[model samples]
Target: MEISEMNLFGREHIKVFKNRPKAITEILSDGVQQFGEKVAVATEEHELTYKELDDLSSIAAANLQQAGIEKGDRVAAVIGNRHEFPIMVFACSKIGAIMVPINVKLAMEEIEYILGHSKPKVIIVEQEFTKKVRQAAEASGSLEAGSRLFEIEGENTFSSLLEQNAELTEAAISEEDGAFILYTSGTTGRPKGAVLSHINVIHSVMNYKYVFQTDDTMKTLIAVPMFHVTGLVGQLLHVLYVGGTVYSMKRYQNEAYIERILKDQINFLFNVPTIFIMMSTSEKFQNHSFDFVKKVAFGGSPIYQQTFNMLKQAFPNAQLHNAYGSTETTSPATLMPVSYPEAKVTSVGRPVAVADIKIMDSEGNECEPGESGELYIKGPMVVKEYWDNPEANLSSFTDGYWHSGDLGIMDDEGYIYIRDRKKDMINRAGEKIFSIEVEDVLKSHPDVVEAAVIGIPDPVFGEKVKAFVVGPSLDPDDFSMLKEHCRKSLAKFKVPEEFEIIESLPRNASGKILKNTLKQVGGEKNA
Candidate 1:
């Protein structure tokens, strides 16, 4: 089947199609119609097919109705990446209830902010987190006994709700209706919420199938957190669209991921570069034959060459795809072609089918080859706006295009090469510096384990480049050794003015650098 281009070649053209958005509910129903008995999800003890998933979510939907959840109302679920997540997400989508999947890793204060923002009618949680949920509820003054709490781990309690309501009410949702509010794991400022419409969800699902050539025979190993758009929209939602089975993991256990790939005969796998680095570096991942995994894709961060070398030696038969996307873009706008005889180890490829992406400089002017710039995406997949965040919406979207703050450059062939963000850049002594550029140059050194660069206050200079480095028992004040290494590679001003040797860099749960904290760790610096 031949495909028409999305209007990426023309200027100011947004593209067409997806007018009749079979809402998320309609998409799931279609999956059931085509592959009713095909397995849709599996855990250690429980398994379900398309038919079973539909029936189970229908029961949950009916229970939500009984609990007085109205259409277009927001609902919170305190759950992990287990099978329950997909079930609840689908149920909420079917009922036009905005699904707010709370990240289990956030602080109580962070969790409360989301609760206050959406003001969910009820909180669906498991027994494992009952105490935390109860505490949050009490603090929010939503401690009324009438409020519904659907506990998945409570056997008798959940069973009773299922028995009472086995039918689901169809939602009156338009293509423009909001389906989810995925809060960004913001490393710098407050977490901004991205509002995804029904059309955005459908658009991503269709794009996944179209770009990846997914089919019903495909089986996926989902290890990324379901709260993020990549796991929720790119992996789970796309699998449902293609009628594929899923082997779900609560967390990224290296052994479990390798075990599932070997034992379950999984075809496609989705995760971040961190997970891949862990897997490829682990000795256990080498013990198995992952020949069954046809497509192993990663996003969230740039992957290094060492890890790719390890994967090639371990699973040479598996094809590795580097994906570039984010929550606001509904996950994937670029489906990087698999690395060749040897992986390129860089270059995150061109835009996927159904996407229009370009790399623009700081002034919104298009960047030519070899020039780094911000990446912008415009298509059906881009979210309508941030949830009730007028300030963020005004700053993020420009003339129907979503400005992905990520910095990159497009080559002559249209392949994009990502650099550090413009905001993540540091200015020291009137000289510009990119943290990733400094970190990359530092990591290339034999002794360095990790490196993060930031600017610290200076009396003479406006700000000085300070590096927080992690290495195997090294001294930061060894200017003779460290400066020599930098002198061989980096420019004079880009080299760190001071260095602080630490065991590790402070990072958020999403594996992003907490540069603010690093900057605050300033005192009498050494170099």
Candidate 2:
């Protein structure tokens, strides 16, 4: 894995992997050449070997071409964690079309905005989501000009696209061409599409392979949504690059997931810490044998020490890794090393081989080693710019570095530790408090399953800390004990003045806790 420097898109000395697959489609072709008969992707109902994946995607691409999809056309998929998702990925890549994967859980307004913004030439949706997609398309006026719609399981289905008899013509696709337009969760404002080029995705997958030391023997389960970079680029594409097998889960269920792991002999696991928390606390998970698992990766949110300890116990033989990245970075900018000192457990490890990170203060000066600041990442994996928002592009990208909008600290050893999001950082009477620190401390309590901390408006202090906890029913005694637990670990001022118990935390499609949704909840004090 040699690296060479190239001046790409006005950025000088950008490092890229040499002699890699030039396009996303080439990944599948290489797999087909080496692991042709082996299953490339599978679900409960359907499976496709490398050869079938290549051949069927060719047919699908031909059908798309026949339906007038040409080079650089946008093909949006409002689908879920199905086999068809991966097929559509290759189909678009093969025909030089850009794939726009919309999170199925998004509201109609959000979906409409994405449809209108991206202006996809064709939208392939799942059966359950077709009506919503239709309404969104209509509202967005995307269907007025004849944007083709194909359902995954019904009439005018995507499966039929693979059966159509149309000659596939080769399109001139380049490594730098946009391969996917991934929309960020619109927590602060309207979602912006992060345009990931073919090289961005390929390099991300390569980084995972390099850091994880994974190979063709990998049997990974797609426990997360395929639309997400973690599942798509991190698990699916990474495994495919190594000529490994991928098992797709239509929907993630804890018990069913454990069964699938045992049934399929899944050896590699990648998911959010929340999923691992639930699985680690499950009785079924405790009874199962996970000795076959080689590596386990978790990210998207902070993990309490209790959860990390539980994961270690559950997957005794597996190496646990903490990853940190965003859609702008494709998937991983930083990955935990296989082994490190216990003191580095809280750190997100160093940046990937091709990634360069800078911690800059508010005044734009680079921060000292231990000082907290914004994390800016530049790498082959990082997307060059947002889809069509010039304002966002100008503000977000500076000299090829994508502003991560995340507050972090890099130690003298180069291990990066995420403090909080820049906007999510709480200023309490001029005292700074990172929500993740309080949330992690709260989750350390045995009775607390999960916790989220937010800054509530206050007259005295600029803002006061409030916590939302999802845990056992708390009596007066239990509440006091929980408060005591937090007081012992956190500063008195950092402890939540109010605590609310809820059934579960609201999350976006990516399994990130929606603090914005929690902020809208009335200030009713229960705990």
Candidate 3:
């Protein structure tokens, strides 16, 4: 099928969608009125019905106003998977504040950089992370005198702000207004904030609803972090849009995740491939009944064919889907059709109703079917631009399409199959690890002369980081010290899983490191 024909098919599919809300606040209001007594969100500690959610968000909005937050203000949150996170998100929407959800796994330096870049008016964090956030804010000079740092749970916490019974005076929020600023790591060793408007989020949610065929009866167990587009826009917000219930988990523990799936009778689930691999291979997974699950989606990293087959056998009643997207695309631009799982097992499936995907060559010309090229996506679900980063915007977007930097190909039927990456970014499990970022840290060591980082295939994690170094000492003891040095600056996931001493790194005439050669070397060592 032609691209235009595919798009028409998508639009036709979207035409049947009913009762769609224009903004986030409207979604909340509509949910409360329609699903009133139904549960909207739940965690291990508490549950909130739609009506209760509406009431609590109003209080939270009032609290935000009392705390001096104005319309268009940025509010950063460093909390885990909790009920209050969604409350804060809806509260921000009602007041026209931009909610910035920080990734809880980030190191102190990473957090400080985000706080400095976003310069939020208020920082809401869990009590455990309060000191770290405070320190980060202090270092970034974002914690000005009188700026509030509210904890998720504590004496003077987010709940304390809800004590006021004052009526919430709604701000004039528009569909075009920014709703979220999610930070995504860049290849340049810095994080870029993707500004997602209300429209962007709504379109993304619609994509999920249409692709997954979700409804009010659907119950999802959100194992992913809310800071990610998949968990927030795909699972959480989409569930709200359809008047469905969401069971939130603070963290993913294999056993705990399985228990919740069975106990909660979760019908919908979306997680990375690694989580599925762990669950399917576990002894407990065989004993439990997954009869309640209706849909299971996996993305962010490649799934082994063996694991995919095992999941199919494990959940015979559930529709297994493969999704493809990035933070810039909100959640998923493409979702494998449930009906064609076996036929298109390797494909990420076709573009969603609101999205348009194109494969372009280096010269910006569209590639023929089955021809590999960089994938570009255009849609309302795609982020407008990177927050305050003109350089990134200039390079990443062209002719209204966001360059995904992912190498892919499309078949005659419009299904997209991702082949490789155009950038040197590693998908370790589901975590994005840029090689340059780790290489910079490795090169910082005084004993190191030069460093090169490459990703090697792993059975559990999709890929593992391996470093090739040219240093003064090639001893095993010296390499161990180098690994320790990396641990001090980089996240544990980014640290090299294996180290090799090399006299020199192979480079092209332009002096660019030939990472392919290093990948081969690393592969041979693993073999």
RMSD of each: 3.5, 1.6, 10.7
Point out the higher-scoring one by TM-score: 2 or 3.
2
Model 3 over residues 143-245: C-alpha lDDT tens digits? 7745578887775678786776666889987766889999985434688999998877877787787778889988998878887788898789999999999
What C-alpha lDDT values do all the predictions have?
A: 0.75, 0.89, 0.81
Candidates ranked, most accurate by TM-score first = 2, 1, 3
Estimated TM-score for each candidate: 0.89, 0.97, 0.79
* Candidate 1: stretches off by over 4 Å: 1-13, 16-21, 143-147, 154-160, 164-166, 338-344, 446-449, 470-483, 501-505, 522-527
User: Which candidate leads in TM-score?
Assistant: 2
Per-residue alpha-carbon lDDT of model 1 for 1-527, expressed as tens digits? 33343432122455545343458887678889999998888866578888888887888888887778878888888888777787888888878899988888777677777777667887777678777776776666554534456677674355554564446777888777888988888676788888888877887887677667788888887777777788788788888888888777887788778877788888887776667756764577766677666777777776666555655566567777777887888888787764432434566767876677777876879878878888888887788888878899889877777888888778777777788767767777667777777777777776776778887777777777777878866885564587678878889888887788888777655556677677667643421
Root mean square deviation (Cα) for candidate 2: 1.6
Query: What is the TM-score of candidate 1?
Result: 0.89
Worst 10 residues of 1 by lDDT: 2-11
Task: Report the alpha-carbon TM-score of model 3 versus the true structure.
Answer: 0.79
Among the numbered candidates, top lDDT falls to 2
Query: For candidate 2, which ten residues in a row score worst on lDDT?
Result: 518-527
lDDT of 2 by residue, 1-527 (tens): 89998876568888999978889988999999999999999987889999998988899999999999999899999988887888889999998999999999888889999999999999999999888899999999999977989998889888779895999996888778999999998888999999999999989998998898899999999978989988889998999999999998878999999889989989899989889878876788888788889999989998667777887888889998999999999999999989888777778889999999999999999999999999999988888789999999899987788899999999999999999999888899999999999998888777788889998888789788888888866544566677889899899989888777888999988899888888778343321
lDDT of 1: 0.75
Model 3: CA > 4 A from native: 1-19, 186-188, 425-527
Q: Model 2 segments beyond 4 Å from truth? A: 522-527
